[model samples]
Target: MTAPASLRDHAYQTLKRRIVEVQLRPGARLVERDLAAELDVSRIPLREALRMLAAEGLVLLVPAKGALVATFSPADVRDLFDIREVLESLAARLAAERATPDTLAPLTHRMAEARTATVSGDLRRIAAANAAFHAEIIAMAANPLLSNVMGPLAARTEWLFRLTASRDPVEQCSEHEELYGHIASGAADEAATSAFAHIAAGRELSITLAEKWSDPDFDPELIARGRRRRRVES
Candidate 1:
């Protein structure tokens, strides 16, 4: 028999993935009764899962009302990128400083995977590959504290990556290649500079869309879908 903790964890991962993938769009109401029925879990475990998501800033719980999917704004995007710039740059520097063929293998593979996905021209695949590349870089840093700090922000980071999928994948992939060259060559300073520059370029685009999304008339559904279509067309 499954323990209560197991059920709760299962519900948490499912809900977290749905939210990150934007299947549960920003600002969507999460009715406990409906969610419990849909997930085929008891209200107790479902609520536990929601509380975990809430702690991660993916859900908002009201005192009297139920929960709602957390919404992002221009300020939020700015804040997120600001944190990322600092953290990711440090990771890149550490990765470069500690560079060895063995440590760099996964990043190399991730870059190759990203290039393949870019050539395939599937937006979702491209986004996933891009995220994996960054994750591999973080892992290469060999800093458990840094990884723990970044772990919670993964969902939000992926959501932003999806929103900005319209950006030129070729150019982004090229940037990653350059960063990889720096790390591979053990150029710590160059690696850090490259990482900061890459994130700074993406930051502007994210902030722009977030600003546009602030308009009440803007359709939230288009956040991922429309941008993705535009990329494919281009």
Candidate 2:
């Protein structure tokens, strides 16, 4: 029989989801007491969860200050995308060479979901579908080493996307379709090249958006209020 999840695991997943989804924005203070009460978990498990997230680069724990959400600078964003471009290109190339119809089916389904999500005009769904599509590609690559490295990078990438929130659905869908075509056709070189180009473009866009939106002295309270307001409006 499968083992049940522990409280630490549960807290970790909950906090990680909130961070990735931007409910807990970058650089927001993580008060242990508040979080413990909010999550209805004991301090021990919550601290363990924060430690796990910190190891994954999702949370920051300072010497004097307590835990906070990880913040990405423009340079950090560029560096991450640069690494992603290299790794993801390799994944696409390997996927093209190795993927069978069974492996490719999930990607095909995710592409359709992305298209539908694009038309629905829900940014959250669009983001989720886009992530699912790329994750499927990585899974098809069949490399545990690559997946392990890409896992944390992918989480950071999703956080960046949530911050920018400016993707053009039609354009993104078009690019995804093109990439999918190369992978499905088993064109290894083409798949790698396409993946590189797609990520490079995203890197540029993310950098630009980060520069435009970033505030050096960002106020976490204001960010929290804005998020609350957006939630109510939606």
Candidate 3:
């Protein structure tokens, strides 16, 4: 049998999922005692998990009041996408200039996985596969410095992808395929352009959704309902 998960790991994963899915609303207080009881763990593991989430930028550790879910604003979305555009475009360019078919196999695999996930209407899987595809591109780019810079942002990027899950995953997969083709053909300029276009296409929509989700009065239940509706529609 598989080994049981550690309390800290379980708590971290559970809290992270709740936060990413908006079950734990942004700017809401996270009481240690309540969370500890809810998760059926002692305060030690709960606090450890909170610290981990804080490091990933999903939770804020206040000096006196305790932890709060991290908030996102439209400006924050734009800022993140701006950074992604520049860095990801450069990564695609480098990958195009350096990648071979073998080097790009991981991206191709991720693209296929994303397509399957989209068709199956698994939003979480789609986000994860899409993130993996990007990670592969960064790795294929062969720049350690770039990878190091991007490593910390992977979790945040996946979080953003989930918030914008209303977007057509099919279209996103298609764009990933196109970018892959450019990289495989060693067309550096085309690959860079494709990367920028892909990221830009989602930027405005993400900002709009962020505005709605970040509103103080917004209902978290709506996020779940929307995902269910999208699943049916897809």
Whole-structure CA lDDT of model 1? 0.83
Specify the highest-lDDT model's number.
1
lDDT minimum window of 10 residues, candidate 1: 225-234
lDDT string for model 3 (107-206, tens) is 7787788778888898888888898889889999999999999987887888888888899998998899899899999999999999999999999899
Per-candidate Cα lDDT values, in order, are 0.83, 0.80, 0.82
- Candidate 3 clashes: the total is 0
Please give, for residues 1-234, the per-residue lDDT of candidate 2 as tens digits. 222248788888988888888887677778777787777788888888888898888988765546778777677788988797898999999999987899898889998998998899888778778888888889899999999988877677767767766867778889999999999999999999999998888777788877765567765444433322222000
After aligning candidate 1 to the native by TM-score, how far in Å is the CA of 50 from where it should be?
A: 1.3
TM-score of 3: 0.84
RMSD, each candidate, Å? 6.7, 4.9, 7.0
In every candidate, how many clashes are there? Answer: 0, 0, 0
C-alpha TM-scores of all predictions? 0.86, 0.87, 0.84
Clashes of 2: 0
